[model samples]
Target: MIQEIKPAIWQILGKQPGRNVVIIGGTHGNERTGVEVVSKLKSMIESGRLNIIRGTLVLIHGNPRAIEINERGSEPHADLNRSYLVDLLEREPTGIYEDQRAREIAPLLIVSDVVVDLHATNKPSEPFIACADSSGHEQVYQWFPSKKVLSDPNYVLAGKLVTTDEFVDAHGGTGLCYETGQAGDVTRVDEVMRNVINLLIDQNLVEGEVRIPSNECEIYEMIEPIVLTAVGFTFAEGFGNGSWEPFVADQTIGYHGDVPLVATYDGVVVFPKIQELRKEGSPLAYLAKKVNERKKPPRD
Candidate 1:
C-alpha cells in the first residue's frame, strides 16, 4: 500500500537512505502522468524489479483529490501548483486548499537534493523541461537530456505553491517541471513516466538499469513568458501545440485587439492554452531553442 504524509505528501520509503530524489505528480490534479509513473515505480520496488541505491526516492502525489476528479482545482477548487509563495501562506493561511497542501510539502522539499514534478498540458506538444534561472538548472538539464530547455529569469510568482522552480533555486537543488503531453492521454503519460523513472536511475538517484535518451530532444530557453490578463485575448480556437512555425525575429503571433503580441526573439511555441478556465489569463506561448544550438548547454 502507498504511504501517506498528511493529505498531500505521499512517499514509498526505501529500506535505507542516502541522497534523496523527490518525484511529484498530479500537482495540477488533472495531469496524471507523474502519479501513474510513481505508482509503477513503487510496484517495481516492492516486486524487487527496481532497487534503491544510497538515496531515498520519494514519490509525492501533489493533489490526490484533483487527480480523482481529473480537474485542475483540488477539492477546494485551488490550483496547488501556484500556491508556493511564503507570503501567501502567512496572509490568507487557509485561503485555498493548495495553500494548506503547500504548507505540508514545503518542509519535505526543503531537504531534497533533486525534485522532479511531472505535468501534462491541455494541448498536445512535445515533452520538455522547465527550470528557473538558478544553478539547479544546469544539474536538471544534464540529468534529463530534453529536446529543449525553458529557462525563466523572472521572480517566480508567489501564487505558485510547492513545485515552483524558485523553491528549487532557493534550496540549492535542481527542480524541474516536466510537461509530458495532453491531459489524461495514457500513451503520452507512459512515455513521460518511463523517461522520469529512467532519469532518476541514470542520475544515480536510484539503483536500477534505466535507459537515457541517446539523442537530446529540442531545447527551448524561454526568454520571457507572456502572461495573459483581462485586457488581452489570446487568439483562441486556432491555437494548438506545434500549430505555428518558430517565430521569426520581431514577428507577430497574436494581438490584444489591434496591438500586436509579437515575438521579440524567435523560438518555438511550448504551452498554448486550448481549454477555457476560471482564470482570465494563461500562458500564451513560450520561446525556446533546440538543445544542440545552445552556446553552453546545462551540465552536471
Candidate 2:
C-alpha cells in the first residue's frame, strides 16, 4: 500500500544508520517523470535488487494528489514547493493540503545529509541540474555530472527553500534539484534515476556498483535570469524549450507591435517555456557559469 501523508506519499528504504540520502519526486504534480523514477527506485530496493551499503534511502512522493490529477499543484492549486520555509499550520489556519505535507516532511528533510529533489520542466530540453549553494553544487557534480549547472546567487535565492537551505548550510551537506526533462520522457527519466542511484552508491550510502567517469565535463552556471514581464508583447509560438538562440544584451527577442522586447542581459536562452500558460513573472531562461571560488566567496 502507498504510504500516505496529507497530500503526499513516502517510502523508506535501507534504514541503516550511516549516511542519509533523501530523494523527493513530483514536487510539481504534473511532472510525472520524477514520480515514476522514485516509484521505480522504491520498488527496486524493496525487491532486494537494490541494497543500501551503509546508510538509508528515503523516497518521497512530494505531491500525490497533484500527481493523481496530473496538474501542477494540489487540489487547491497551491504549489507545494513554495510552501516550505514557513510555519504553514499557523499561516494557513484552514490547513492547505500542501502545507500539511510540508509540515510533515520538514523534519525528515532537516535530518537528511543529502537531498535530491527531482522534477521535470514544462518545456522539452536536455537534462540539467539547478543548485543554490556553491558547495552543494560541487558535491552534486562530483556524484552525478550534469550537462549544465546553473549557479547564480540570485537564481539560488529565487529557487531555494529557506528552511531547506538552512539545513544544508548547518550540515555542510549538498542539496540539489534535478530537472530530468519535460514530463513523460521515460527514457530520460530512467537515465537520471540510474545515475542518482549510482551516486548514492559512490557516496557509500548504498550497496551497489559505483559508476564514475574518468573525465567529466565542466558544469556551467547562470549569471543572470532572462526575466519576462506581463507588459511585454512576447508572443511565444510553439514550445520554446531550448530552441531560442543565444541573446546578446540589447538585442530584440520579441516585439510588442513595433516595440521590441530586447535582451536585458547577455546570456544563453535556457528553459524558455513558450507554451506555458503560467504568470508573466515566470523565468524564461538564464545565463549560467561554473560554480567556483571566484564566483562564490567564502562564507563567514
For model 1, residues 1-300, the per-residue Cα lDDT tens digits are 246666745565555566677888888878877778777776777787766655667777787778888888775437777776644435658656677777777777777887888887777766667776344465555545456656555432222434455575566666888777667776755566566666667667566775433544344454555566777655523433452247666666666666777665666665665546524555555545433444344544
RMSD of each: 3.7, 4.3
Evaluated against the true structure, the overall lDDT of model 1 is 0.64
lDDT values of the candidates? 0.64, 0.63
The runs of at least 3 residues in candidate 1 whose Cα sits more than 4 Å from the true structure, single-residue gaps closed, are 75-77, 86-92, 133-145, 156-163, 203-205, 209-219, 225-245, 281-283, 286-300
lDDT of 2 by residue, 1-300 (tens): 224433344545444667777788887788887888888887877687777757666788877778888877776437776666534434644478777767777666767778888876666766667665454455555555454665445534346544343344445556777777776676776677777877787768766676455424434555655456766545333313462245667767665454666655654555555444344665555545444323332342
Determine the backbone clash count of candidate 2. Answer: 9
Query: If scored against the real structure, what TM-score would every candidate get?
Result: 0.80, 0.78
Error of 2 at 108 (Å): 1.0
